[model samples]
Target: MPDVMPLVTAVDQLADRLRSLPQSRLRQGAAAHGLDLARELSARAQRLEFPDREPRSVPDEGLFVVADQVAVTGRDLAEAMRTASAHEVAEAVKLVEEAARRCEGTG
Candidate 1:
């Protein structure tokens, strides 16, 4: 608690490093998920359109594309989530080890 600067700096560096990753790699699952989420949201939004508003099939078609994307993203996310727990456990162990080292050094 006395000094959080190192943690903040570490987090910032990690974020910057992540930001430097290739866009294609970053968006690997995004297009699909974005399209899906957008489609679902659009469908819900369309239903809220004014009763007298002119019908638009074009929007519906666009939403279909989005829905497809969402499906792809969902699949990717599910796989990632499944593997993520293991990674989380490893990271937690690493953090504990690092903290123990620091405590020993200080003591």
Candidate 2:
């Protein structure tokens, strides 16, 4: 059989990462954006097992809540991945310093 192990592992990790997002905070933002974050999460959580068949159906309310939390957590991880692509601490530090400078006088 084909080596599907790696793919399965990746999916599980993705699912886990998604589940970690903070739904409570994201929910309010999602609402403003006309998104149903919880629904998105539930849908993703249903895929945690990485089934070969079509994903199982998730309840709207439950999914939305889960999805919201997942999104928040996922976003941080995604940003870290992208930042890593920059390939240097100096570059990352520069970005952080710039961001900090933006709020320096305001707070």
Candidate 3:
């Protein structure tokens, strides 16, 4: 299995940042970005775990749940990628890293 600590770290960091954001900030754009990232990550995991089926969309459950959604989805992706190729793992890492950078608003 590939080392997934990097993905874990990146996603954890993003989730913590999102959780710490003030409600005002979350309302501004943080939650939106977090939700987007969560949705994308969820899709990636679904594809990894079930490539034959169309991935379902992660619902917009509201701003408050964004952080948890992101965290859970990230973990799900990490789990699904455990049996994946190195290139696939690297792609996931890159995705999380980019999302982290873009989620600066949540920090």
Candidate 4:
């Protein structure tokens, strides 16, 4: 099994940052960015877990839940990719890290 701890840690840190952000910051753009990332991660997980099935979109439950959405979707992806190729896992990690970086200055 590929060690997916790095992905887990990255998402945890990103979620923490999102949670700590002020309401103004979240409202400005952070929440949207987080939700986008969550949806992407969720899509990837669904594709990996069930290639033949249609992926469901993660809903927008307001800014307050963005952090939880990111964390939950990310972990779901990590779990789905547990048996995936190392390269594939690395790509997912990179995707998440890049999302975190992009969220550094949300609007």
Candidate 5:
């Protein structure tokens, strides 16, 4: 089974990136939303209930939600970067999307 820690770490890194964006209604909203999703995912990962056996996979629904949130947050970040002509930030957002896809095993 693949480790889920990488996915959680990626989500945390994306959230940090989002939080560093310039303050604006869109940025604030997206960052908050993404962070909340990341937090929930992290919590779920930490609280797996299987007692005697190692889990074989992450929940598909949880992966889907993470992917969706990452896409939305990336879009929001791209839009924020566009307003400031921050091409580097836009690229970084793309990377975040890629990481999210990888996490979902869809990359």
Candidate 6:
């Protein structure tokens, strides 16, 4: 049987990181969406019965939220990229990359 603990741990860590990010419009939106995804994953993990014939895998519900976050964050970042100062542009790029990485299961 595949171990699901790592996936759960990753999701939890990503959620915590998102929550603790600085309070910018992009981070705020992503944090809210990420927390919702994390809550859903936690709830699903608690309900798993691990029956003998079942396949062990993390639930896909969080994927939708991740995609949503990416879209929203990407849009916001694009706006920042268009007019922000050098430091702000760099920060926006970092935020967008982080969101994409989380969606790709590498964050």
Q: What is the C-alpha RMSD of each candidate to the true structure, in Å?
A: 17.7, 12.4, 1.6, 0.8, 14.9, 16.5
Structural similarity to truth (TM-score) of each candidate: 0.26, 0.28, 0.91, 0.96, 0.33, 0.34
- The Cα error of candidate 6 at residue 1, in Å, is 3.3
Better of 1 and 5 by lDDT: 5
The CA lDDT at 97 in model 6 is 44
Any idea what lDDT model 3 has? 0.87
Candidate 2, residue 54: lDDT: 61
Model 6 pairs in collision: none
| Residue 39 Cα positional deviation in candidate 5, in Å, after optimal superposition | 4.0
**After superposition, which runs of candidate 2 have C-alpha atoms over 4 Å from their true positions?**
24-58, 61-107
Among these predictions, the greatest TM-score belongs to: 4
Candidate 4 lDDT (Cα, whole model)?
0.92
Candidate 1 residues 56-96, lDDT tens each?
32232332243343333333333333333455334433442
* lDDT of each residue in 1-107, candidate 5, tens digit only: 32333333554566555444444522324444454444443333333433355433323333224445554444433333333334444445455556444333411
The positional error of residue 36 in candidate 2, measured at the CA in angstroms, is 12
Q: What range of 10 consecutive residues in model 3 has the weakest lDDT sum?
A: 98-107
Candidate 3 Cα errors over 4 Å, as ranges: 105-107
Question: What TM-score does structure 3 among the candidates reach?
Answer: 0.91
Each prediction's number of clashing residue pairs: 4, 12, 0, 0, 0, 0
Question: How high a TM-score does candidate 5 get?
Answer: 0.33
> Each prediction's Cα lDDT score?
0.35, 0.35, 0.87, 0.92, 0.42, 0.41
Q: Please tell me which model should have the higher lDDT, number 3 or number 5.
A: 3
Candidate 3: residue 31 lDDT (0-100):
88
User: Could you give the candidate ranking by TM-score, starting with the highest?
Assistant: 4, 3, 6, 5, 2, 1
